[model samples]
Target: MPTTPISPPPIDRTGRWLASLTQWVLAHKRLVAVAWLVLTLAGFYGSAKVTGALDENFTMPNSASTVTNERIVSRFDSGGGTPPLVAVVTLPPGTTASAPAVRADLRALEQDLARAVPGARIASFGSTSEPAYVSDDGRTTFAVLHPPSSVVGDNGPSGSEIDEETVARAAQAAADARVGGAEVRLTGNALLTSEAAGESGPAFLSETLLAGVGALIVLVFVFASALALVPLLMAIVSIPVTLLAVWGLTALTEVNIVVVFLVSLIGLGVAIDYALLVVMRWREERERGLSNEQAIVHAAGTAGRAVLFSGTTVAIGLLAALVLPVPFLRSMGIGGLLIPLASVAVALTLLPVVLATVGPFADARRLRRTDRAERHWAAWARLVIRHRIAATLAGAALLVALCVAAQGILLGSPEARSLGGTGAPKAALQQLERSGIGAAPLAPVEVLTPADRAADTAARLAAVDGVRAASAPEGAWRADGQAVVEVLTRSDTNSQAGRATIGALRDAAATLPATTIGGSTAQTIDFVDAVYGSFPLMLALISIVTFVLLARAFRSIVLPAKAIAMNLLSVFATWGVMTLVWQHGVGTELLFGVGPDGAVQAWAPVIVFAFIYGLSMDYEVFILARMREEYDRTGSTDEAVVRGMAGTGRLVTSAALIVFLAFASMATAGDRDLQVLATGLAAGVLLDALVVRSLLVPATVSWLGRWNWWMPERGRRLLRLPAVTPATES
Candidate 1:
């Protein structure tokens, strides 16, 4: 019997277009380089100006909590979703709040505080005589100042624009002047969030530089030559250009502050990854005896096409966030969408030019070791293929275990202990905790009701389970036929019990005419419901679209199905890691110096799913695209597995390490949410590259044999592709 001859691989319009574009870029390398240099400079300038434009607000439009908050702000001119700043006053020793002189002093201090913080509605034992405002010892009295929500400037209505330091200072000054021998400190949700924001992790610039250094080290090790610098150069151009786009986006709509860190770190990782792919392919072409220009074009045609597909997949994952109702999440989606697009642009245009010009000089200084990585990876791939059943079983078992672990993830606000901060806010929080007055005052449920029904509402709420106290203040809390009844729960609102309490309160209030619950806690619940209520839709959209995209890119139904399944496993495993580390406190204290938050941040999972799904799929594309190409060239499944792993194993792992370093640097952020987010990203990338790409993908492909290349004629027509003949069929 005679062996059949292998046919040439099919080239699609995208590959041909990329080839032409690469030729164009090569002909105008100097112009392309100068244009990127100018864009980088503009991006640096834009990054500086963009911070002021970023919004920190989290808003859910048209929800009950939102409408009630708007009503409260409009009518009472205070207390509309923003947490009230608490002024904790410790009187001179042995002076009870009931004493005439102490009462007089308290009343005087209240008046002074009202004057000190303009547009602040003051509620205290002195003003309401509610008794709940005083500690059991009676020596500590507290005041709640509901600041005007309208004070928030054009930055968007999350109340982040309020000058927290100035407010704290003015309140302290009032306490010192009016209440002799008394100490007062300020703490609130707003103050704590502000302090956390003020606390620096590694500086953004330092973190970026650190990530760059780490990436360079990995690149150096991978290439063992000066060619390593090409990827870094691409990253340098990509990050700034993305930032510049973000700044322009800010002018059109609100961009979240978190996008800055994302653009810096994720942009660095993605840009470098794209460049690494193109450069590696170019070098491989050169090693095959192609001219420098031919290498650039061939690399562009192959790896360039993969980069485009990978970037589109990333953008598609982020696009799911746009369907969410929350404003900040939508902004995040928009900002994150820019990262991959900018990276793709740089990789396709500027990267080819850099390789054509600087690449030869860089590649001239060759490493002593040649083909060692490929040989090692080829050996590993053979071993995996030889034991395909065992490899498949082990990988599946690990992923299933992680998926089981993820079922326990709790979604809510971070625990109080995890909101680490220093100075006056910390001191005040400590003081309040010590005084036996729990955090109820910080997250009280504000009931908006008719003035005539205010007292009735408070009385009914007080009798409900989990209710610690309820007070309907007469003076400042009432305006325009609306009365505010503040209800305190026995548990902190950030806790599970507190969330249940809030649900109960809403249930109880549902029967009352013209009554609704609104506060920071209520808004948090609304936010969770809004973002997650539509989560299934977002997940479906991402899944279907990604499957279709991958099916087209890989030109096979089985391959795309396997890719999606592996990507999901990678993501869920990442979530499981987060739950164990952050929620269960398995290694949180040892690693991050924080206790279990008892829950992951409410917004983290969705963002993680969106990002990790796409990012991990990058490795899938890198590996399988090569496998497909190899299969086309050799018409042998076993050869495809070995050669594909040999081609991409080092590149995939190196790219993953660079991305991991970027996220690891982000984990140093003071905010717990950022820490969790970064941990998820890093874990997901590492897991996908090392396990999914290395072992599971090869084993499964080898097990599937020639079925990996099967594409139905109808599917090929849908993608506008040539009909496929299985590699095994010749």
Candidate 2:
């Protein structure tokens, strides 16, 4: 019989398209590189100016608290929206707050503060002469200064109108003028935040530099060549381009201040990650004896495609935030969505061009052998496959335990003690606590009422179960046919009892007409309800969309389901770790010099969930895509699992470490919310790479065998993907 040569399989549409695009990039290497350089320069400028545009507005539209706040701010110039800056004055031991000279000094101090801070409304022992303004011992009196409200469209008040430094200086000078020695200290949400952030918190640039250094170290260990620097360069280019996009976004809508940190840090990690995947795969192809151009195309057809899928999943995860009613979070989603897409663009377009020109030259000066890393990973994969059931069970058990710990997570503001500051703000708060005033003054409930019924409403609110006292102060509290009643709770509003007190007050106010509650605690409660109430729907939408995308990428129904399940477990595990470390104060004191906060900041969990779910999916896509390739090439599921792990295990591990280091750098921030977010993301990356991807995924794939590659006809038709035939059937 004459020899009949077998033909190679035809290239799929996606692979063919990637190969052509890679060729085109290689042809115009210089032009692509120059384009990215121009965008990067613009990005540097955008990043610098973007911060000024960010606003921390947490208002929920159409919510009861939001409606009440708008009306109050409109009617009374100072009552509802802005948190008051409290100035505490303690007279000498012999001089009571009621002393003639002391009252005169307090009145003078209030007038000075009003003069110093334009649009400020002051209420104190001098302004109202209410007994509630004085401490039990009658030596301490505090004045509440409500800063001016300037609501700019839907973004709420543009922060505090009065400057903290100005308030402090004026109050101090007036108190010093008193005949009896008197001391003044300022304490409030704004002042405490500034004090806690004093010089220790890292800026976006410094944090990016720190993360870059950490990533450099990991890259050197992995590549052991001048090529280790290539990914960093790609990141340098990717970050600024993403920021430029964000800058453009700012022109259209409001972007959250937090987006700056996320773009710098998360953008750095993701850009470098995509570059690392493509570069490593190209190097592997070259080592296998492909020509330079051939290697680039092959890498693009495989690893480049994986990067596309990964970036899309990340974008999808962040897009889930758009479902939220809160404007800032939705803006965060839009900002975060730009990050991965920009990175993918750089990796796919700019990266291949750079590699085609200088890759071989840069990779030649190797400090260590590359094969050693692969051999170690291969050996580990074999061991895992040998005990597949045990590996699966162990990984599941560990993740389950972490999920249990997450059950204790409470979503609210941190307690007063948890606020970071060792300066004047801390001392003032402590002094107020010692004076038997406690945090009640810090979080008073403001009720907007009909002017005629003000006193009656105050009396009715005072009898509420958790009400400590209620006062309808005269001057600033009454305006425009409406009166403001300030109600003090027995406990701090962030506390459980305080939350209960707010609920009781709301219920009691429900029976009263044209009466509504508006204050910090009420606003916070509305925020929590608005964000979390829709969370289940958001989760379902993300899950469904992600499942469909993964199914099309993997061409396997079972595999996508498994990947989604694993990613969810990874997210919950990360949350559990955050709960223990931050909420329960496990190692928090030793690490951050702060004690247990008893609750995670209300915004941290949702942001963490969005980032982790998508980032974790990246690993799943990387590993399984390679496994699918190996399965198609070979005729055994065992061989596919082993080969897949051996190929992608090291790459996934290195990428995870790079990302974790980037997020970990955020812990240096003085803000507790950022620290919590950083902890959750860093922990999630490690847990996913080490546990979920390493052991559980390979073990489960191996155990599932032929079934792992099966896709139903209906799914194939819906996805417009070819039916997957298992190696065993072939």
Candidate 3:
């Protein structure tokens, strides 16, 4: 078909730049396509040769937990006592608490556990050691098993001691318990860890596979052409290569699987997502007036730059997690930095080549859908613009309210045995209460005094407000010249009082003895310290990076600031939901079946912040790219906001759904931690898609009016920032 020639057409700078860019792309199609194919194959082959880097705690080197594991290892090497485990002896509910059968059964369990797991010594007894470790009632009994260092390394404790192949021989000495006709149960750090791993594994595999297939289906439904899926098909091949490369690097370095897998997920997800975004726009460009070559270049230069800007901001934000002064977080930061770069490279190279070869088939139907002006998205944008003030206020208020609830969150405690009333820890705790020690929660405090003043230090520690008892064992291997004090409290250890208890113990021991606390309680305190302290720094880094990058992308300082603020607000809102559902016991029974005891997961806040910040910026690019494009033509912020939000809303929602589905599937894993994480992430992304991107953003943009285009003088002079190409107003 012959195209109409332009005569005295509009002389717009943005359009002229796009036209020049298209001419440049058309001139080099063959070379670019060939190079893209070569790179894609190479990336795939490399990943295939590399292994899958998983967070296999048992196999993971000591580097994952350097600080904590190093101390435990040194202590064990010095002949310090081993870590303790819990063994539960169950009896019928109606049975007498002090029955002879119960006592005999408890003794038999001790022997059986020792035989089953060799070197498993009894750390404490319910009757003789203390009552706090067990329950006050007599129906439950606890045998704390402390395995010797010979079998399990302190750095990475062995979860599978008796292998399946050797279990028969090991089981020969194991006592088949029938205590008072109730089945005996044993569960603690070891058992729970084992179960959580098993659950996360299969679910991770299944969800990954299902998500890949679902993403493909969404592409097909959206584009309605197999050729449209070519970009994604390249991604499908590239992800494995990326994953293997990550794994291979890990064997030689400290790079953990979290970086590899998460990056792969986001990389493939975003690469495919970006590919879809550009391909459709390419089709639209062709349909408008340009040849295939001109159209592909226009898509790449415009949408390409948008994706590039978005990817960098996200990468930097995630990378900042490493700056938290923590190791695990550092690894995650590295992973964040690498994966997005890989995704961007693929989108730039692979997608362009695929489009070069199959651009014609993309819009083969040549049938444009009608009623676009009255589409769901256009109506939504109008509603938001009409109610900009009200909608923006509501959104802001919602985030503030949720953040207020989060202020009440307490540190989590995994030490006590009386959580939900169905385990060994509780039984042992109940026994301790009966013995007059378990009534109140306490933080354990161990103090090492100079030999000359050991007795004097112990006497001083005993007088601390929360110190229930202080034992200064002379010449004991557990504490060499140390006074190990048991500090009891009137409040739970996870509470404010409990945190105060730990600080108090340290202060009391500072002058008397050099002290340390090593227990489940100690681990909780350490976690709280690392997470809370790092949160502010994390927020600052993310806010700065996002603001700088987005500002550079649009040459608009105010717009970028808005984007970062909106992103943080989304994360805050998610945190609020978590606090209500997890910390405040609002949805505990319905969601997890157990009433929440203290705070959400120790790492939840950080994880939410990282994911939300990275993903929210995705929409920022989609909307802003179109806004920038429209600004070039109309020079009207309100027009750009409506046009941009409407034009890309469908694609944005599809991308959000892909991420949401992938995360939500984790809820099926059944582990409490996994379930909570999946919920928080999915909720955040969902809100970003509907509430933030769809409603809040356009409303705010409408209110900002002309100021939305304001940019720092420095950005304007660089010219590296792409000039906005404004199309004629619809």
The lDDT values for all models are 0.82, 0.81, 0.59
With a 3 Å backbone cut-off (N, CA, C), the pairs that clash in candidate 1 are none
In terms of lDDT, which candidate is strongest? 1
Spell out the clash pairs found in candidate 2: none
Off by over 4 Å in 3: 1-72, 77-83, 88-112, 126-141, 149-185, 192-203, 365-374, 411-497, 585-597, 712-730
Off by over 4 Å in 2: 1-11, 45-58, 89-118, 125-131, 135-141, 150-162, 170-184, 197-199
Q: Model 1 — which ten-residue stretch has the worst lDDT?
A: 1-10
TM-score of each: 0.91, 0.92, 0.80
TM-score of model 2 relative to the true fold?
0.92
RMSD of 3: 5.8
What's the candidate order when arranged by decreasing lDDT? 1, 2, 3
Residue range 1-730, candidate 3, lDDT tens digits: 2222222113234334543444444456676667656665776665554434444332222222233333533543321222344555544666633566665665676677667766443422323344333345555544554454555432221211212222232223323655566655554443333333223345445656666777777666666666546656756755654664565556665554445445555655666766767776777777689766666667776776766777787777778777665555566677656666767666666566567666686557633452363277777877888899999988777777876876776645433332354434344345444554442332333343455665566567667776554444332223333333333444445555665665676666656434444433445556567667878887887787677667766678888888888888888788877877776678767765666645676666676778778878877888887887777667777777767876788888878877776676566655555666777888888888888887788889889887788764567666465454334333
Judged by whole-model lDDT over C-alpha atoms, candidate 2 comes out at 0.81
Number of the top-ranking candidate, with TM-score as the measure:
2
